[model samples]
Target: MSIKSEPHAGNLCNLQDRVAVVTGSSRGIGFEIARVLASQGCNIVLNGVSNESAIEAAAETLRQDYGVDVLCCFGDVSDASVTADMAKAVFKKFKRLDVLVNNAGILDDGLLGMMTQDQINRTLDINVKGPINTMQAFSRLLARSPSGSIINISSIIGREGNRGQVVYGASKAAVIGATYSAAKELAAQNIRVNSIAPGYIKTDMISAVPEDTHQERLDSIAMKRIGQAEDVARTALFLASDLSLYVTGQVIGVDGGMLI
Candidate 1:
């Protein structure tokens, strides 16, 4: 799809001609982020893992609704080979990559004692290694852009640590650590790296929590309401746009003051 650039109407950040790749963006928070970025004039690459039809539908929606070019790239973010190919396709199609949102991750919640080795490895591979793989693969393309932004979607459990989220928390913490290191390394190239730690948002992932546990989580939030995907999406817009030029290597929480 081709979209001619239009005059931006308001003080919202203008991201014309920019290309963004949002992994695991077929639905949920990643999808909302992709939509918001497309609205801001970015050409979006909607990525998914083994879901060609879903990813293609998402791409089409962005193309029709926002009139922005949308590309569909499907593969597991944990595999370096897969991400390498994804990068090649992005560069082939867009010629430039301005933003990369490593939003692909998996959660296998269980007590450390009950968690099998396979479960632990799967969580770490997807939640931690996935972002690292994509970052390494896209670094060269991101370097070509005048400004590049990398947003890693983390979780509140990663920071505060819940009873059943031992391995998941560790993986998310690793993401923050990677963000700091990557930000320092990429600063010279004018590429910003940051992580967004979302609280108990109303996504399919959180729906797995038991009803009683879920209620307790809701009561703990300062806002007393579950966060919408758009809440986190707006923060991503700030980081992706020039508004956050000075911001890098930080973990912004979208958990409705639950961390406080």
Candidate 2:
């Protein structure tokens, strides 16, 4: 005898009419997260850098598929002026921001000794400083919401170090630190801050991993499989919505028990 599941009447998180900004959402995990948020009744602000056409197309897809209000703001999150402009654009159109997903990041892996200054700086700027800039620019708008949420996209490598990923790990580790501190500081204003530590996800980033190394990483997982973009997207949705109202300063892993 099989049990039947019932369909819910309303949206998952009461996020109807809310506004969310998802950085680097032109494609891949960030785009999936934005789509998930939009499906749950949240208006979305899709952000990307150096790809106006792609970003606009992503926004259009979300608008057409989910029928939710969609806006495109193209800029590098690491730039203060750009982030400020993004914030202004959001406020101008939506008047308030409910969710901020710091998903824009870069990964440049190499032996510490072989890594160049340019590689180090670029990685840190995009991965570490990018979130800092966005949070600073959008925190004011987030504070205005009754259930403001900030979701930082970190990685399991940040928690458990990986070879040749020292610089990348450091950047993500800093994100975790920022999430913890921001949660404490923003709690006074009814805002929640959390980080998602994804592990061995099957995205473009993972595709670039050497074949043998990828297999080794897969074997390390208890589930013995790579994760999907939707895995992280679902976690982001939880943090962005009121489902995680009391959850803050926590590093939730969507890593198929890899950390265990």
Candidate 3:
């Protein structure tokens, strides 16, 4: 891990030939983030729990479009053994990992009293424990890079109270806590840990909202528009590359002023 400072201009080199793992990257925000990194000359390891064919296609698309190596790691990130296997595969293929995007998460919206035990457990496992498992598995590999970046995808609801999202929001808030502690623990190794709290991003979830509810959401945003996945992806690009070497332990809002 390199601690030597470099000007932002020098970040122009971008992550040429670097390797990144983006979980749940078969579609939506995760895929966009992977594509953004690939566009920057970074090789990608696309991870997904199900949808094996979609994951493979996404990896192939990256390889064809960006002309960078892409591998598929299929498993639930909450399983430590799965992440361990993922680390082994990465070592065998790329032999190094420079960036880790913990983008695999799920939402189970229900009031605290109405939520089923299964829903709560699954959300916590995927949204909270998933990042923990992957970070632990890949920390050693990441440390070997010039500098490593860990980008955890949280949500604006995590930073604020949202009705019907109590459990899910708590899970995301836990990720921010993890980022703070991880940044401190990994700083000495030149590994930066941070969280991206996106607000009302354009994704499948947003697409499913009722038309009236959707309009209400748009009205609440200061920007008066929904955020695009690219908006978050570009921010991820900054964090994944040397551009954010000096930035860590932070929660960047790609929320279109929704939080402010």
Candidate 4:
């Protein structure tokens, strides 16, 4: 199941006729972002490390539900060549790009003193270099779009830092840094870039944490509850659409007031 370049239905406001590429969207937060964007009338390009079939299924659901175009590309975004290929595939179908959400990332938990080189490299490659490479590959189309936007997914640990996640935190922190610099450089071309730092979201990524550990995290949030995928999805939609036109180069935490 793949979406055609042109939408098969009428356009809507905010994201009408816009095209958005969401990496790591097979499930979890990325999937929700694609869903919300499709509902807003944006054509979607879906990407993930593996699971081509799953991505295709998700795309098909979006197509059926929203009457919008949806394309699925499978590959490891951490690889520069793969990211370039993903961009090319997207342009081949859509002909133009309006928004990009670099949401693909991996986590490796270990004490800093005991972390291995492979863990460090893999975490940084997927969580940090992936966005940089994707942005570079897609900048041309974005520069020409009417509403060019780039939204990078960071984490609260990136800003506040955390134990047993030094490398992962570092990678997310790097994402914020890239967002700041890219926003400054791309603003002239009408390409808005920003980062979202989420905390303790109930995703597969955090399921490994013990119940007590998770509770501890929830207790710290001012909202006194965990955030849902929709929370981050809403934030992504804002940055991807005109709602955040005057906002860029900023790290907005979607952590239920956890950062506050």
Candidate 5:
């Protein structure tokens, strides 16, 4: 038996006509994904909460740099009605949504014993329910497109469990669970759903950890280095494009062998 090697180069504009909505994309990992998609000619609907000015600035940059249409929707994905509104705005502006990147998530770290109901609800509402609600609102629109994808950004904590992140882990775990079930349900419509479980990606999210504590977290990674936002963005681009057309329902780890 002969092994096959993946092709090294291809045209990068395969997503020229696709339209995408990337939640919490004003900065960090989400922003990087938006940039990656836009670079490939995908129209973008940039999402964020309390970052209207930043969102507009990012959107303008995408339009100027990539010459693609970019619309900014400011809202909290955790709110059901707002999630629906975000979808509506996209449809109204772009008339199609080929990609939905559920990247809006909040992390509240605390031992289970000290975690409050408010903390648990806040984490779950955004990390888990936000994606679900967003998908529900736009599934029909996605189905209308010939090729569609839903990318749920989960975490390694969801799979292996992490101390001091009981509630946060629960929310991410739910994202992984939904990824499998939703992909199965939406496959017949030719719409794919997948989740990306990133290990120690260096984003603003990591700022929550103190400097010394962050160093310890980095030491635990087998790669001996943390990943950048572009690392996850490149993965999102692969899943969003036709390159991974046959892949679905998979929880891909962009985690430098951390799961091992």
Candidate 6:
């Protein structure tokens, strides 16, 4: 199922003509990751819960800014049908997929006892099941590429165990489990699987935190600052490129050593 790399042969970071499917990529960390990958000449697929027009606009930006082919798959990744349909479109357009970034996730903060079943289900569906669905749908396409990479976005809360984020933490932890299992199972296909656990990234989600609590987070980080989306995006670039061909079944922390 392997296709030789003609466009980017022997290049360390060049992803020219390669296809990347990034879930929840309309904005924030997902979009930045897709954008960085696009800068390296990869044909980009942007998936998100945003409306069709918004997602299309994001796609258009990539096409215009990087002159790379961009596809917008507007739908929630939690829906299996969406990933299936996106896979079909991607295979039809590019015939293969080199990288799949599972970046779609939600943060519903609440004590486990106070959380509604719907909240719990929604978080798990998007954060955990979404990656499962995308991996299943795109595995074949990815296996066909000479270099296949799966970068799953996890969070520090998954390992650090934050209060009021029990379910969110559990779901992210589950993602790490999936990464380990997939890396082992898919190694035979030369597909490298890894996870990134970001801590207090300055995104729309982080902006929602209370000012005092946000400062408290800043104090906890050795770097004494919040992270930017670009930080995670660049880490993803390394994983997606030949630079990390030998890396798999590992969880990289992009937390600015916040946990330390």
lDDT of 4 at 140: 90
When superposed on Cα atoms, how far off is each prediction in RMSD? 5.4, 3.6, 3.5, 6.7, 2.6, 4.6
Pairs of residues clashing in candidate 3: none
Clashes of 1: 0
Worst 10 residues of 2 by lDDT: 6-15
* Candidate 5 residue pairs in backbone clash: none
What is the Cα-based TM-score of model 1?
A: 0.94
Q: How far is candidate 5 from the true structure (C-alpha RMSD, Å)?
A: 2.6
Q: Name model 3 segments beyond 4 Å from true.
A: 1-13
Report lDDT per candidate: 0.91, 0.92, 0.93, 0.90, 0.90, 0.92
143-257: candidate 6 lDDT, tens digit per residue:
9999999999999988788989899999999999999999999999999999999988989887778889888888889987789999999999999999898999999999887
- Candidate 6 error regions (>4 Å): 1-10
Cα error of candidate 6 at position 243, Å: 0.4
Q: Which pairs clash in the backbone of model 4?
A: none
Worst 10 residues of 4 by lDDT: 5-14
lDDT of 4 by residue, 113-170 (tens): 8988998999998999899999999999899897799999999999999988899889
TM-score against truth, every candidate: 0.94, 0.95, 0.95, 0.93, 0.94, 0.95
Candidate 5 lDDT by residue in tens digits, 1-260: 99897665455336897899999999999999999999989999999998699999999999999999998988988898998898888888888999999999998899868988888888989898899999999899999998899999999999989888888888899999999999999999999999999999888888777989878777787888898899999999989987888889999888887742
Q: Model 3, 25-76: lDDT tens per residue? A: 9999999999999998999999999999999988889989999999999999
For model 5, give the 10-residue run with minimal summed lDDT.
Answer: 5-14
lDDT of 3: 0.93
Task: State in Å the error of residue 3, model 5.
Answer: 16
Better of 1 and 2 by lDDT: 2
Query: Highest lDDT: which candidate?
Result: 3
- Looking at candidate 1, the ten consecutive residues that score lowest on lDDT are 6-15
Can you write out model 2's per-residue Cα lDDT over 7-44, one digit (the tens) per residue? 35344465789999999999889999999999888999
